[model samples]
Target chain A: MPRKTTIIGILGILLYIVGCYDGLLVAPADRFMGDIQRIMYVHVPCAWNTLVCFTISLVAALGWLLSGARARAEGRAWKWDELLEATTEIGVVLGAFLVVQGMLWAKPTWGVYWTWDPRLTTVAVMELMFVAVLALRGFVDEPVRRATWSAVVTLVAYVNVPLVYFSVKWWASLHQVQSSPSTVDPAMVLPLRINAFAVLFMSIGLMGLRTQLARRQRQALLGESDSDSTASSGGAA
Target chain B: MTGVMQGHFDTVLWVYGLTTAGLLGYFATLLLRLRASKAPTSGQTRVSAQNPEKTS
Candidate 1:
């Protein structure tokens, strides 16, 4: 691992410990939900990072599609493609957890493990869409075609991201509106803010590692193609 | 802090415990995949040719 990533990984661990301290012990409990409300510390941060990862995937998808033809042909454009893969995979993982966390939080407050509410439904659909993107990428045999198809799928799937965010407001639902500094108690916001950055740093470090793996796999695949073509050319000569 | 509130702290524990497990589990999976990709195999030579893996 790079020194910078190592530093970030260390920083993330430290911040997570501090954030847990504040969130679990220091912050006052909500009068309504009481201590169970503390779940928001982890639940909310997972939600935030889920959206962030998908947004990053959308940008990476755009990068892969918009790069010049020469860049694509020379295999230089695989960076964006691999990044798209990494972020999409990470987003799907985070989104799955977000749903479970929301369910856990909801059971105590809403009195049900789940409902067909707008927010929860949209998030479920969004997670499944990104999961399909990962599955399709694995199914394709050709690298360029796999990258292109998944990128296009990512673009289409991103349409649901905004829907997921707006679902709570667009219609009556059990889920609360977005949390903010103004809305939450001053003491509560401190831990929320800390954990948000903690999750962000950890996600970044993970993305870095995941992207490297994607690149390495692509390189191996492409190298096989190169070797095959080279042998054919030599035989012809 | 209230007696009733203390009764439901389990909800908080559920999310905290699950989220920690999820994050750590994903990180472990990622590291294992990366390690698998680095296995000594025919593809290792090809991957090294594109851009050298960080030696430092």
Candidate 2:
């Protein structure tokens, strides 16, 4: 790992620990939800970071498509393709965890393991779409073709991300509207903000590391292909 | 902490425990993968020639 990423990750972990202390021990329990509301420290941050990761994935997808087209025309390397793969993989993992965390929180608050409410339903759809993106990449053998197809698919699927965010406001649902500093108590807000930043920094570090790994894997695969082509050509000669 | 609301500490503990475990596990896996990718291997030079992005 890069020194900068390592520093950021360590700082993120420290901040998260402090935030957990504040949230789990220091913050007063809610009048209504009592200790159950403490789940927000984890649940809300996961929800927010999941959206953030998918948004990064969407941007990376666009980058891949545009850079790929340019690479074909100008003979440039396709780093964006590697980035798209990395972000999509990270996003899918985070999205799945987001759903699990939501379910955990929901069980305590809503008294159910699952609900087909708008927000929940939309997020589920979004998660499935990204999973399909990963599966789609696996099906395509050609790197360029896979990159282009997945990029287009990612853009198409990203339409649901905003839908998931606005579902609570657009339609009547069990999920609460977006939480803000104004909506939550001052004491509660501090820990929430701390945790959010911590998670964000940690996510950035993870994505950087993952992207590096993806690039290395792609390089290794390309090397094998090159060697095979050279061997076949040498045999013909 | 007078008037501190009580009850459901178990719920709080579970939430924090699970979240910490999940995130930490994920981060650790990524770090391990990164280390594996960085290890020098016989195929490393061939790959470096083909894709010169230099992930370092």
Candidate 3:
């Protein structure tokens, strides 16, 4: 990992701690939900970060597809493949976090551990789709083939992300509509925004480290293939 | 339901506890994978030395 990303990660963690303190102690309890409303601080941030990570994955997937096509046409590098792999993995982790946090919030607010609410169901589907993309990577042996297929699948799966976001608006569900600075209390907004930015920075930092790891893994695989081919040729000679 | 206090302190604690644990666990796993990737294992060193062009 890069020194800059590590610094950003540390800063993000510090901000998150401050935001948690403010959310838990400083912000007044909600009139309806009381102290349980504090769950919004972490839950909302996880939800937003999950979407952001998936968005990054979508953009990287598109980059990979386009660059891959261009590489075939003009014989160039496919650096975006590394990015696609990294972002998808990071997105999966964030998506998993989102589900767990949402579940925790739902149990108290909705009186059940889970329900088939449209928003919840849509988010679950989106998470599973991206997870399938990760699984796809492991099964493919050829580098180019794996990258191409994963990118295409990701593009198809990305259709669910927007649906996850708009599900509350599009359908009547137990989940609340998207909260904004206007809808939420001004005092609550500060900690929520702070945690949002904290998670955002942390996601970027994790993605950077993951992308580097993916690059290294790819290089190692290529080196192994190179040695294998050379050995075969030497044996023939 | 409006303007009624629902003191669910247990819920708040559970949410915070679970979220913190999940985030920390994920971060630890990522760090471990990164460390393993960076460590100069014998196989990786041999591969890197063999394929000079791939390193850069």
Please name the candidate that would achieve the greatest TM-score relative to the true structure: 1
The iRMS of the candidates, in order, is 4.1, 4.5, 4.0
Predicted candidate 3 versus true structure: per-residue lDDT over A40-80, tens digit per residue: 89888888888877787778777756653435333233456
Weakest ten-residue segment in model 3 chain A by summed lDDT: A228-237
TM-score of chain B of 3: 0.54
Q: After superposition, how far is residue A134 of candidate 1 from its true place, in Å?
A: 0.7
Candidate 2 lDDT tens digits, A1-237: 467866787788898999999998899889877887888887787778888888887887887665533354432335566677777777777677778777877886788979999999999999999999989989986666777788899999899999998999999999999886778999899999989888877877777787677656654545533223221112211
Model-by-model DockQ, in order: 0.38, 0.37, 0.47
> In angstroms, how far off is A182's CA in candidate 3?
2.4
Index of the highest-lDDT prediction: 1
Error of 1 at A135 (Å): 1.0
Off by over 4 Å in 3: A68-78, A224-237, B1-5, B38-56
Give lDDT: candidate 1, residue A182: 75
- For residue A195, give model 3's deviation from the true position in Å: 0.1
Provide the RMSD of all predictions against the true structure, rounded to 1 decimal.
5.3, 5.8, 5.1
What global local distance difference test value does model 3 have? 0.76
